[model samples]
Target chain A: NAGVIQTPRHKVTGKGQEATLWCEPISGHSAVFWYRQTIVQGLEFLTYFRNQAPIDDSGMPKERFSAQMPNQSHSTLKIQSTQPQDSAVYLCASTISAEQFFGPGTRLTVL
Target chain B: AQSVTQPDARVTVSEGASLQLRCKYSYSGTPYLFWYVQYQRQGLQLLLKYYSGDPVVQGVNGFEAEFSKSDSSFHLRKASVHWSDSAVYFCAASRTGGYKVVFGSGTRLLVSP
Candidate 1:
């Protein structure tokens, strides 16, 4: 099933620069979720999309962060004017039921 | 709001020794608990989950967890440890019928030969 796929295993961005992460969910999976993982916070939910429509994004930062799932196949997470605090591993997951299949994740380093 | 707590940040054990990782959760209604493991440079993988019935659930890689509603705890255990079992484990909790999941800080296990 190849599970979920995420591009750019690692990323480096300077402070104030913009960064974009991409994820391709498993085929026929209708739910896509984005999460941030760090040593301190562990894993935190950022947003989710069900059947190509956003369902909840309350966990997303109020500023400089946005996510969109234009179709059932792929989703994108964009961070504008990135800061040092934004440096963390971004994980993407897709689920058909309650069990989620996770991607390897994109590690973002904001210097 | 639902939350999970993994009290131990790090645990060390010798190969062939018994292992246990503790988890506690807080929720108002029925809870769905899960254990996920992350190896170095890898994504998190589901170890096991508890939905209903049997408080004890078995998972992949010979791992098992017990759910105790009376104490609001779900602890992961393995009869014996192997060097390959060294990894970071996370405990997550979600309310029944809810999509959002709350994860614990995680416990890093170090298994020595």
Candidate 2:
């Protein structure tokens, strides 16, 4: 298996621009997770999907962050009007059970 | 609210020396505990996990963790270290009823030759 696949290993966006991160999960895995990592905040859970349905997004910023998993194989995390504070490593993981396999994250940089 | 805490922000050890990374957790229920290592520019990889049964669990690459409910801690240990073992370690937990996994701030380990 390829584990999980995330697109654009690095992203650069100007302030007020938008950033969309992509993730392709492992085949047959029913769960997907998104996390953000920054030096100050450490690692924070952003959102998650189970069986192609959003289960919980309490960690997400209600105004600007959004996630969608329209199908089983892939999911997307979109940030509208990206701000400098949004710069961080966006990680994605997929799992069939308790053990989740992660992809090399996309490093988002907002200037 | 659930949280994981790794007290040490950074740890340095000589190669061949023993290693220990501390972790403490808070949760309303008996949660599933895990230790993950993140290599440079790579995603976090699971080293070990604790559910029930034995308090001490063995993991890949000779890594093991002992869970102490009394202390509310799950600490990762390695008998001997190598240069390749340098990475950031994260302590995490998940509730049984949900899939939201909470993570610690992580402890960076540096193995010096």
lDDT of 2 by residue, B50-109 (tens): 988999999999999999988999999999999999999999988865566888999999
Record all residue pairs in model 1 with backbone atoms less than 3 Å apart, i.e. clashing: none
**What is the iRMS for every candidate structure?**
1.2, 1.4
lDDT of each: 0.93, 0.93
Tens digits of lDDT, candidate 1, A47-74: 9999999999989999999999988889
- Give lDDT: candidate 1, residue B26: 93
**For candidate 2, what is the lDDT?**
0.93
Q: How well docked is model 2, in DockQ terms?
A: 0.65
Candidate 2 off by > 4 Å: none
Point out the worst 10-residue segment of candidate 2 chain A by lDDT. Answer: A93-102
Distance from true position, residue B49, model 1, in Å? 1.2
Candidate 2 residue-wise lDDT, A1-111, digit = tens: 778999989999999999999999999998999999988988888999999999989889999999999899789999999999999999999987777789999999999
Candidate 2 clashes between residue pairs 3 or more apart in a chain or in different chains: none
Which candidate leads the pack in DockQ? 1
